[model samples]
Target chain A: MNEPQFALRIRQHLNQGARVDARVAAQLRAAREQALARHRSEPEAGLALASNALGRLGGVRGLSLRVLLPLVILGVAFATAVAWQQTQRVAEVEELDAQLLSSDLPIDAYLDQGFAAWLKRRASQ
Target chain B: MAEAARLAIALAAALLLLAAPPAAAAPEKDRRWSELNAEQQEILVPLEGEWDRLEPAQRVKWIGVAKRYPKMTPVGQKRVQTRMKKWVKLTPEQRKQARENYRRISKVPPEKRGDLQRDWAEYQSLPPQERQRTAPKKKPVTAQ
Candidate 1:
């Protein structure tokens, strides 16, 4: 209906937490009226015409890349970090394998210095 | 004259022997386990057992730490000794309890753990009297 009545309805809805603000409701009602008038004036070329035009223009894709580029960069950065962490773990495993294969010392010898010293003494003798 | 020719051949053989990649000296095996101080030995014995079961790669990983043992600070050494003492003193039941506690603590989200640590710091900073006051009180039961 009129703006004042629409605003009152919106205020009531907002008070109940339905979130319809007076200004927004009024704008919505105006848009609906305009849409209805357009349909009445051009019955044959209705909402379908608007829908076809939106489809041809690829609707949401028309938004500028400025908004989407940051999201794309963030996703790439997250994936790279995950990949780098995986590679780091793999490298650590490889290094451990290399060290193990190259060393000749018995595991106990590394832990026990007295045993190592005694062995050295025996070898020299 | 034939003896001089044989001597030259012997010299050539000696040079060839010297050139043959100094027979890969057998890997220097360290036998340091017996040298540890009693306390150190006590700590190391279990570690040795665990090390024995480890794959070569795992053993190699720990060898680097072993090599740096002499460079460890006195405090570091003492801390290690204390941990070893504690490990030795624990009953199997107590060790199980400690392990369960560790697992429970580990499962907590990092943010929650950070918050808890911060709270602990705050609690520790409070005066002894204030801490006593904040401590939980036993509730009295009323008969219905």
Candidate 2:
């Protein structure tokens, strides 16, 4: 019989309320456990790119989404962070240099903070 | 199949990392000392010795100053050149300190700025030993 009919027969057999010996009951429970294990995975979900990649490759056996998802996420985040940091560094240097070059105060005025403090003290006194 | 996907992702990430260096470095490579215009090379002469050693952003900033060089007053232009010459000689830590000092001083009132300038002149007039005594407290420049 096809799978549906076979399943129906097994269901009916179990519902018959017949008493079974210890060995047969244990064997049935083990078979059900194996069946449940086979059905452990849900349908593939999330991130069309990731899912599509696996789908196209006929899906990898036993590769958990739990691990793969985080790997993709962390890689993307870290790369983005690195690129942003470099750009900021370049821009900051450019603006600071432009301002320093354009300002009226002699660069020496800028080179020493203690001199500025001295100027402040001189002004106060 | 999922394993292949992981491999593909890793390869793609590797490619992205590989791609970043070329983009950042390509512009720097293009800014070789030989590539600068005659005027730029002249205006930035002070940097010539260390031009290649400078970061790409440094070279770009100096080039900008050269472009604006003609518009500035003679004194302004001279000041920029003098400042740049001294700037290139500074260690990175000293540069950081200079930047902090500049930012702080820029905020002083315009009327009071004259006083600060006069004090600066007086400070410069001090003997070498006196100037050394007045040196700013040394603070290590931490990377931002």
Candidate 3:
């Protein structure tokens, strides 16, 4: 058939309302059922997959350390400061102790009120 | 390879965190004679010439003494300055002897120190001949 005639015949048949033969009709029904079954199973499988992902993320193993990092750094800084201050204090005390041990006169002679009184009395005498 | 790089970065960060404290905790470096602040320099002016030769411990002690200088009464300050000058002039042997005497005297009980002081004073008050005759016998220095 000529191209115009063939195109006219296909359009007329589409407009007239076509029907499938029994075998083709059965095949179409089976394909539709298979697609619907696959569609139904897909949603359930997707939900199960999402649930598994959420479960893994909800446990302690999934916790992030970033939240605690600042606290850890602050604690370290404070400890360092305290240790440095303690050493400075110890150096001061040791210096004082060494001086007290090395002086020519007794420490009590320098600090004792009674000794000072005697010195005054002897001077007067 | 990317995961390994991330792990290495994390480990480096952790090591930095661990090392930071000790690095900061180390005592400040020994200061040079010229590095003393205005106040320290003023207080330690007497030892300026000998500052370079002083041992680290001696310098530390002197710095501590300088820090306490301003708090002292004028009389106390004068006495300390005088004593420091005397201490500086002493030979090492004389200083050692003084330290021995100091340590030995420190051990005497507080109550007994008064009696000892009285005896020493009375001894000093006597005539030179009597003082020499009454002088205590020499004894070995006590170990601290």
Candidate 4:
């Protein structure tokens, strides 16, 4: 089928919003097969180049793993150390809070309204 | 004579009490702003009203920088002054826009930034009249 005729038939089917006819389906299938066959037969230099490149990369993969594995491990260890330090700091803060609550010093007593009033009176005098 | 000596000793003790500095004043906690030098003051005045609005960590960060680089070069001082002046002139919305632009520029790769700077230097080297004539009429379209 001509390109224009094939496009017209596809458009007509789309406009009708119904399923395509068997003949149109067969034509489309044939076109797709033709394209695939051409693609398979073509001598693609890009593919050959890519295969050669991958072969080269395979040699470096071992070296890369040796270098990268330790780096990855170090990064994980550093992250864990930071998390542990943060947890320790939180624990220390809680301990301090507990100490503040239990202490004998009358810290809050000094902040009493009566004491403030007395200080204000003294300042005025 | 003994009475006079006793009186002198009492006066000496009183003067000693008066002259002694208070222990409570040793830890003189005051605004860190007052300790800034003239050049630092110029750089920091832009952040004046916004000083207390800053987080404790941010305040500490700036303070550390100020302490680390106590004195700046003449060109650096001038640049800081210009930036501060520009900062003060900007509206809140304009400031926000400037900050977003800065963040976007910073996110670009260092090599790209260097390239852009080199291009800008070349552009600036052109004669003023030529530069004005060649300048784009409209702002460059930026992708969202």
Candidate 5:
């Protein structure tokens, strides 16, 4: 028989409460009873809802950790670089200022045209 | 909607990284002569041809001096420019001697600096012949 005819005959037989071998019938009956018992014992909708809510919270926390950790590291690195640069610049400025102020020439003498000739004359002598 | 917001936040975070200026790859202390900024370059222009030949300490001093140049008054700036020109003309030995003399003078107490200034003024007022007579004579070089 064709596939449609075969299916229709099986449905009609099942509707008529057809009997199989005693052993096969017993096994089928036990399987159906077990499935119904499991259905009755299944978890409540409230319990499932609570578990889902906790899972969502955990997901958000995981997301925060993933994003936040890198950001903190980057921030620290940037701060350290800036601090180091500022310290270096300040030290440089201080040293240069000391050199400029402590020099013997009073700065203006170095600019005097006559001083150059004086230095040269002294050196030549 | 919540997922969309989280995604937007993540995008913002990523964009923040993109928007920030890149940190200097090398420290300012390690900057080469060619790497100097325009202002520094202009201020130290007389030293440009010999920048690489300068010692690290000298380079640092010049760069530091240039950095402070903008803070100086017009007269101070003019003095610095003239001094820089004079400094560039000195031989290495003369520069070294100048630095030593500066260090020695700097050690004098502030109150005593005036006395030193007076002595200098008296020396400056002496006649050339008299000044030469009092000046220290160089040791005559002997043949090996």
Candidate 6:
């Protein structure tokens, strides 16, 4: 048969098939709706077949470390600041110690407040 | 190979988390006198007798001092060693006062410093009664 004749015959058969029993058509319509709903939902529903949202985040590590990272960073930053402050204080002390240790001024001469009073008196003289 | 790389990354992350706190906690961490490098040990030798007795923070400070030692003039180095010997014997109150004196003295002009130091020496040589007369009057001693 020629192509148009073949197409016309197929269309006629489809039209006749369309005139189905009401109950059967209703069943077919319900099935088609169900299939359409599933197809529309395929992408989202596919994930459920694998695992939940939490599990897909590479399991426990992702969950724990994501939560753990910010907390640990905060703790470390605070601790490091404290350590750096203490280090700065120590450096100040060290510089002072090096200075005082190497200076020509005697410790007794340095420490005597009366000596300062006496020096002022001598200077005024 | 990919699995191994992932595991290594995860392990490294865990280790980084574990190590960070201890590294930050080093302010109070102690190092033995012997743990000091040769230069530190040699420069810090004067403190050896007191090393084990010193606080961790104090040891850290002394190590810092030692690190700067090589740059000092020979006389300055000798003076440091000599004064450090005496320095360790001072009470905390005396040390505090000495530091106060240093802060004030350092601000004096270089030329006047010698004169000031000489005056201090002369002032100290005065008889006790002479110094008493020269010194600003203190609050009268109360009967115990």
For each candidate in turn, give its C-alpha RMSD to the true structure in angstroms: 30.4, 10.1, 20.8, 35.2, 21.5, 13.0
lDDT of each: 0.45, 0.70, 0.59, 0.47, 0.59, 0.70
> Which clashing pairs does model 5 show?
none
**Which parts of model 3 are misplaced by more than 4 Å?**
A1-125, B1-29, B70-73, B115-144
Native-referenced DockQ of model 3: 0.03
- Each candidate structure's TM-score, on Cα atoms with residue i matched to residue i, is 0.21, 0.54, 0.38, 0.25, 0.36, 0.55
Candidate 1 local lDDT, residue A21? 86
Clashing pairs in 2: A60-B1, A60-B2
Model 3 vs. true fold: TM? 0.38
In candidate 1, what are the lDDT values of residues A1-125, reduced to their tens digit? Answer: 99999999999887887557899889989999999998776843654455456556766545433334344455655554465555455445433322322233222222322332223322345
Predicted candidate 2 versus true structure: per-residue lDDT over B1-144, tens digit per residue: 765776676776777666666455322223778899898888888788889998776677677557667877787677777778788778889888888887766665556546656767888887777766555557744569
Q: Following a full C-alpha superposition, what root-mean-square deviation does model 2 have from the true structure?
A: 10.1
The candidate 6 chain A region of ten consecutive residues with least summed lDDT is A60-69
Candidate 5 C-alpha lDDT tens digits along A3-97: 99999999998977756888988999999999988886574455455555655877643344435545655675566557657656656544554
Per-prediction fnat:
0.00, 0.30, 0.03, 0.00, 0.02, 0.46
Q: Which tens-of-lDDT digit does each residue in B3-76 have in candidate 4?
A: 36545655654554444333112211224666666765665676676666654544543443333333555554
| TM-score, structure 5 vs. true | 0.36
lDDT for each residue of candidate 6 in A1-125, tens digit (9 for 90 to 100) = 99999999999999999999999999999999999998978864654544445455656433444344455556765665566667667767788989777777767777776775555444445
Model 6 alpha-carbon drift over 4 Å, by segment: A1-80, A117-125, B1-29, B115-117, B130-144
**TM-score of candidate 1 chain B vs. the reference:** 0.33
Q: B61-127, model 3: which lDDT tens digit per residue?
A: 6776776677776765655665665565566565555554544455655554455546556645767
DockQ of candidate model 5: 0.03
* lDDT at position A79, candidate 6: 66
If chain B of candidate 6 is superposed on the true chain B, what is its TM-score?
A: 0.65
Name the 10 consecutive residues with the lowest summed lDDT in model 5 chain B: B19-28
The candidate maximizing TM-score is 6
Off by over 4 Å in 4: A1-125, B1-39, B42-77, B121-144
How far residue B136's Cα lies from its native spot in candidate 5, in Å, is: 7.0
